[model samples]
Target: MNNALEPSAVALGTAGWGGGWGVEPLDDGAWAEAERVASDALAAALEAGITTVDTADIYAHGRSEQTLGRLLAADSGLRERIRLQTKCGIMIGGSPLYGVDSAAAVESTRYHGGADHVRRAVTDSLERLHTDHVDTLIIHRPDPLTRPEETVEAYLELASAGSVGSLGLSNMGVAWVRRFDDALRAATGGEEGIACLQIELGLHHRGLVESAVLVNHPDSADRAVVGEAGGLAELCAERGIALQAWGSLGQGRYTRGTEQAADQDREAAAVVAEIAGRLEVSGEAVVLAWLLKLPWRIQPVVGTVNPDRLRAAAQAPVAADRMDSLDWYRLWTAARGAPLP
Candidate 1:
């Protein structure tokens, strides 16, 4: 059975590999070119020793998984070189379970976490991914209508069948995860449960850090409304859950020059550039390094399709080790654009 959760310091994200979210869908010719580019990026990532990859069923309307599948199929030894992870539960147009009206389904989106949807989604994801078992299966988002028991039932069944290796959750807060973990433990008799938690974390996106530091401030009340009441990194460490950060490079806002940047991003960019120069690394590495400095061994899912930038991100762990507490706070305070709370 493929039941292991061995993620590295960084995970290569394929969100932009096939391109289907908000952006216009590509034609066959363009898709072929995109896959070619993705192949090159994967090659570079492998060369850099980044063995974990993160993708989702809804990414590029399933094209991302399909592209990954084709690449792995083309190379017999490729599957063994990387730990593959994919997410389900988000239903959008182009999904096999999106009903018969394919064209109409593209105009809408929903979250489904029932037993049947979960099972079918992962099964179909396996088919698209061209793999018997995924190293990790994460629910893309929380389904408000579904019960924890229902998800646990599906997860156990999938794990037993070896269709999914490990379980994870994305875009979910600590309180909800605690409840879900409790039910998952009861279902598995405490043998298995959540192995990772994926959330938006980076220099520009510092809600996870601010969530704790702003506790007594007035912003804390506003944060509670959006489910950022505490530290996810702390919770993940306490529960032995791997904290995988998406948008770990701030989506290039800090590294991609400041000509069009907002005042806040511009300021953050200046600090990041200074730190990068001092460390003798790319700004991309400096941004990712900031997340690596956290107490938890947070794995940043670097999504850059550019091979050079991806390789730069691979250096973040080393740069992080070289960073001091003073510089770390410098970047944080610069990104926040204000004094420490």
Candidate 2:
């Protein structure tokens, strides 16, 4: 397939690759089955021309990372063709699971970003991913236990050792990013700060966009997703921090009807469908296209497991580029259930 857009435009997410976190595998057969499913999903992603895969160590309690490792090992040239991005610093089931002598029981997850934890986490992650260096290593979530300087120090150590090519931050605000960037420059004299920021952005989760729209209108408390002061998109644009949006599909609320579907979601779905029909594309394309047309090069992390849907997502750039500014705002306003002020 010909390259339509940049490989980073649509990143394949592997959180569901190793299978949902509900039932533990009973025996070797179950483990094999999970691996098969994970392998197939990744194969589907590749067939769709996605070269960026986003995964986390805590996903399926490390099974997700390990599966990717095995897949890379089997295929000699696949790793070189893709940009593998994985996240660290999220703790699950108490202490570190991988590299332990005993099996790790799947446990609830929470954030942990201590300097020691960060080092150990990246170490374990590299081992599981079967990679010398990941394309991008993200913090996953901010850890309150560690200060900004401590986080940068950990990142510096990893960068020096070639364990991670660069660092990214997930679910962080503009203030935290600026603070960390300043610390990074001061401590190491390195010009680079956070290279990317992964946050919730979609038809439903408009935290960054709403910050700008709802300025001076606090009463629109109903519309706040992350409650930023405003200008995150602008800041990210200025700093060249590529915004990778997770949940870019609104968790499938746009295509699939839900009981909790708000009025705006319904309206947005209608408009999206109309556009899709007019353009002869899938509704999924419409939703993803809307995000693609945003000002910045917002890479949407598509978690779809279906191969056909993955192919449709790859077609977003063509459909998205066709949308004019007027149509773009129509979808945005329909999602907000209010006209732009």
10-78, model 1: which lDDT tens digit per residue?
899999887445445578897788789889999999899888999998887778998999898888878
lDDT of each: 0.83, 0.77
Candidate No. with top TM-score: 1
Weakest lDDT window of 10 consecutive positions for candidate 2: 98-107
Candidate 2 per-residue lDDT over residues 90-111, each given as its tens digit:
7665434542642343255567
Cα lDDT of candidate 1 equals 0.83
**How large an RMSD does model 1 have?**
2.4
- Full-model lDDT, candidate 2: 0.77
TM-score of 2: 0.89
What local lDDT score does residue 194 receive in model 1, on the 0 to 100 scale?
A: 84
